[model samples]
Target: MRYIYSTLGKLSAEQLGMILPHEHVFVDLRTPDKPGYGQADTASVLALMVPQIEAIQALGVTALVECSTGGVGRRADLDLAVSLATNFPIVVPTGNYREPWIPAWVHSADEDELFNWMLAELTTEIEQTGFRAGWIKLSAGDDGITPLEARILRAATRAAVETDALIGSHTIRGSVVMDQLDIIEAQGGSPARFLSIHTQAEPDFALHRAIAARGAWIEYDNVGAVPVAESTDLILRALDAGLGEQLLISHDRGWYDPALPNGGVPKPYTVVSTELIPLLRARGVPEDTILQLFHRNPFRAFSRH
Candidate 1:
């Protein structure tokens, strides 16, 4: 079976290989009052990241999905640069119409204006810069989708309908899952066109199964060795429930410097490549199963297949 990847505006075919669907090259956050916290210098990011990118390539990781959001330090120019430099097929989202994260100027503007701005960004980046982002990304706080965010979601759905792009999102927990989907579906969107990230953290299988029943892919992107047995078991149980095709696993680890003023987890790739996958292998998870979870599943989940 061959694999295809689309994360940073490029799609390429390759032999069936591992693909980490949720990750970041070097993401930094710029919260208020922490002016120096998140700075995305392309030269520096590429310089520091070349080795890690090469390492992933050498390890047979054919592609990656970079989930950098607006306030979370997303830079399309940098993403395009890395894709070109590394020749890695990536899918970056043309986003930011979501509430609380859309540019502050959007509040004064109508939803249509805000959405049009986001569309412009995505299209400009794709057509002019040669970046080919295939997904639309949005994030929600613990409250699920806010009013403004709902507008963003609708706009994104409309955009996806036109472009045939997929939708991927960050919903905090199980309680809000249905509500999140409500907005998407209201706009004529469905689970098949969406990826619900961090499903393993939702507390039970019933909730995940409910989501899958609706046709969305439940993403286990943040799973890792940390947080102990709970995380590991969450994944194992999900697979055991016969929901493998509906799942996509990743370690959402790459964004923090404990040494820096702010603290956060390291990159997801480091945890998966260095520790967790090996641990799972040592624990006797078959290579083919692991391959399907980390590779084929994600491709099918995000691609318009």
Candidate 2:
């Protein structure tokens, strides 16, 4: 059986409701060395972000993927606090981001050290949050992955293969995602367990197909951030090309920023519910396909069998 790790616990596919495959609750983009980094009071974050979570719940989104990984100031403690408060399920990842965003320690650490850290987080806890990581989230430079980033990628993929966790990168370029898949395969990770996040940024539709053809999932995650027609078109085309099972969709819309006052009036996480689905139905996407996108795909993408 395939199952996913949520804040609620290890849950099978039948346990998950409509899912937002990629989103965030709290993210601090400031580099770790800076002041005000990783210092958001849980009370303040809960007060400001819980309502955003609940609103999505009212719309039937029972689970969300909190894509804030280490280099971007991932706050697993905050994620747990919110989950406990609302009784909602959140799946968080274990990995680091690309250069400059990556912490100083990564530059000096050997590949095994990096792999062991990620393995511990996957098998144990994240920063003492008592919550083991559920997925793998990382990023790459737009031009290409830096040496340190490539080293981290190798380590991450090894951990991913060991744990059967899904690995997604905040990589904007499709070619870089191709490079990442190569590194992952070199580490003996299944390409099907890989996800090319922010794939919309790569306008070359052929790259999307190419990555999917190699058994990697292609994510169009910025649903609410742009014109609905543009997002609708990309999705329709992918569906037309019969890549439904290889595709994942999300708002990428979250985020309670610690840097902002009251988390800076977060953007709504409702585009998928309010706009996209209805548009998809209008354009002839059947309910089963919607069900596959919202439920089955996320489970199969994130779960370990």
Candidate 3:
């Protein structure tokens, strides 16, 4: 069954409502070798992040894609607790992050081993926590994908092909994304199932169109962090270029970081619901198109095909 797997349950797109395609509930960005990198008391994390999750629910945002992955401290079990407490859904990732933050074991692991790990996590459960991952979260370096990073990405790409799951990368450079797609295609993964996350980091909108042209998802996830006008201008330009179907927008916000005291300050996941949508409406973006972006596109992008 093709479905968007959530922490609570497997649901259809309509069941998910508006989705923050790229957001974090709890993240530990410290290097894996560091002390207490991805570990946190579930109760402590829930206490800090549940209210933030509730705040978004009030604004009609229902689910969010938890971008926390292996290198960056993904705790699907921790996120599942939050989903149960607030009756909210969280889509989790089953992949690794970029270099430097990547663990030594990952560097030593071979391509087939990495591929097997991801396939098992996607088909079975992550860390044997009784929760399956809904998609793949990956990242490439600013200049280019390293040899180790390329192996990991290649493994993720192959696993995504096998499971019919989506692959989203926190890629910095547009050129690197093109390289990543080449590797994915070589491994039999389609660009249609790939996502160029943090697409705004690449200042060239021409590259944005290029990504969309290749059939991958182009995500503008820094919505709340940047000026509303700047965000809208890019989004409107995307629509004008006839790339609406391949576009996504989000806050890239939230995250209860265990590394910080009291998990630091979490940004609210409300800008897209409260601000950007309204601005788009005022700019004559049709209601149907708005629904397509927040409602339909998320499901299409994340659902297991």
Among all candidates shown, the one with the greatest lDDT: 3
**Relative to the unseen true structure, what is the C-alpha lDDT of residue 160 in candidate 2, on a scale of 0 to 100?**
89
Whole-model Cα lDDT per candidate? 0.66, 0.88, 0.90
State the lDDT of candidate 3 residue by residue for 41-75, as single tens digits.
88889889999999998998878999999889888
lDDT of residue 35 for candidate 3: 90
| TM-score: model 2 vs. ground truth | 0.98
Residue-level lDDT tens digits of model 2 in 154-243 = 898889888888999999999989998998888898899999999889989999999999999999999988998889999999999889
lDDT string, candidate 1, 17-135, tens digits: 67788877656554412565445556656665555567778777777777876656566666667767787765666665244455565446676775675566555554456555557
Q: lDDT for model 3, on a 0 to 1 scale?
A: 0.90
**TM-score, structure 3 vs. true:** 0.98
Badly placed stretches (over 4 Å) of model 3 are none
Error of 2 at 3 (Å): 1.4
Instruction: Candidate 2: list runs displaced more than 4 Å.
Output: none
